[model samples]
Target: MTKKIRLADVAAVAGVSTATVSRVLNAKSTVATGTKQLVLQALDELGYERPDALRDRSDDRVGIVAPDLNTPSAPEYIQELVDQLSLRDYAPILLTHSSAGGTEKYLQMLVKQNVSGVIFLSGVANESDYDVRRYLDEDERQIPYVTINGRNPNIGVPDFSSDDVGAVKDSVRHLYHSGHRSIGLITGPERFRPAQDMAMGYRQAMMEMCPDTDQTVLHSHYSVESGGRATDTMLDLGVTGIICGSDLLVLGAIRQIRQRGLRVPEDVSVVGYDDSPLMAFTDPPLTSNRQPVRQISSAAVNTLVDLMKGGNPPRVPFTFRSELITRESSGAAPNQSQF
Candidate 1:
């Protein structure tokens, strides 16, 4: 005859009460981590199969969902996030939305594989209009997730992001001090939270510093080509300084400016966001906002791990400050002293 397992047997082996073993077996959140480990060890020693949730903990796998690898900012943050996860003894399974079937399909696959948790890097959660019902619906199975730089609050998860508004405000101030009077902003679509913050900062700074000039703000996709098109409009508006949402956008702006026979910093000065690697090597170099990738990645991993271990979600999103890295791309207005 096959022998059946008993809670009393597990309790005796773990040196805890049957209630504690029962709690651990049921995957109760109240069970302490040490207590849970002890009960699991007892079950293992007694040759009893662990509950599915308990078994899932041993997987130590985390799913990372991000935008296309082609995007300038994607790779840097992804690399840091992977490093952080690995340092915490978790294996990262990277899934780019550019892949076949996109984020929804990959998310389901991760769930089926029983990943410990999922991390989203500038994914659908960052888009204001994207429908997240599948993830938030009560009828569906809930998955543990955390987001980096996410804007939407309805996703109901912990978010770690940069203080975009402050960064833009600082960048605008830098340009104004550089003698850029007719300043313009070229950023991503307003639907993205970061773009919205950038625009808000631009508007606020213009009102404070250049209340006499019209606020020249143009929204576009976060790409080099889009930046070029927006730069053309700014040039027509007599803008002598420009702030872009990303470093890639700044490159496009510079190209368009050169094509028009205007030199960067002489005809127009420029600033960029997301100071990715090797920005200093650009022809004139780049002056941009540096996202604190390492700190954000560490905090993101810690929060996700906590959630996987049954910790409560953070009440508010964690926002980190960004720094402006000044470089050659930014300078004084036309005929102005660049001091």
Candidate 2:
């Protein structure tokens, strides 16, 4: 008969507390490295097969949660992540929730399914939201999880997000280098970390490069319609260049600029983020910031694997770099009289 391996038995053999053993078994992040190793070794010595859930590669199902799939960037990143996981012999199951359902409900649902792990992308809960902590401390406390484009201090889950600050700074600096003095920003809702970081980067860049230009930041949903309205507002305010948060927004802004009989780069210059699919083929190729989707997705998968192995992943936030891809939509700021 196989010997019964209780939590206390593992703790005694490992010379640690029962709680520490439980933490290791549950894949919690607080377990120290030394204690985790001892507990794992104890489990090995006890002649008990590891729990199926804790065993690596025994299961191939991983849950991927995203806020919405309508946008280009989220879907692109999800596909990349899925591909990477498949290469590692794990099958990815996707779950999408709207901004309205709340992250807590979706998270609880995933937990109930006993998924091997979870990866969240652009969900409603952000680094600043307290709801993340509530879910982190709830009924199920021991599942390995990773978040993309979101972070929280109290929650120990690993995060993989783009270097949004650097991206925005580069966008601003690019416009400045092209001689745009009065620049504007069309951004997503302020609550989201990506939007907030981009806005902060714009502000920091503005303060450093063109302190005299009036700061005109317009917050809107990450949609083309909002971009149109934002473009109109910025034009009315005499902005010579606009840095939009997404390529979709750039499309809308460009339409609005043309509707008003103004030519891109000739009337007002534009820079966009997330050089999504097909952006290079647009009427005039989009000049945008390219999110490091491949890097972020790989890091997220690797972190989840580490957690599953009872390893403490990096505590520091992981931010992947972005690059500015210049195209025809942007140019030197047109003469102020052009508007």
Instruction: List the global CA lDDT of all models.
Output: 0.82, 0.81
How far out, in Å, is residue 96 in model 1?
Answer: 0.9
TM-score of each: 0.82, 0.81
lDDT of 2: 0.81
Q: lDDT by residue for model 1 over 1-339, one digit each (tens)?
A: 434669999999999999998888776768889998999999889988776657744358888888778678889998998899888889998888777266557766776667777788874556522434464222133457788888567666778889988898998899999878788999998888888888998999889998998898899998899999999998877888999999878989999999888888777889999998978899899999999999999998998888777688674688999999999988887874322
Query: lDDT tens digits, residues 179-280, model 2?
Result: 888889998898777888889999999999988878989999988899999999999988888999988789999999999889888878899999997889
Cα-based lDDT at residue 197, candidate 1 = 82
**lDDT (Cα, 0-100) at 330 in candidate 1:** 88
Candidate closest to the true structure, highest lDDT = 1
lDDT of 1 at 181: 79
Candidate 2 residue runs with Cα over 4 Å from true position: 1-58, 99-101, 127-137
For each candidate in turn, give its C-alpha RMSD to the true structure in angstroms. 5.1, 5.7
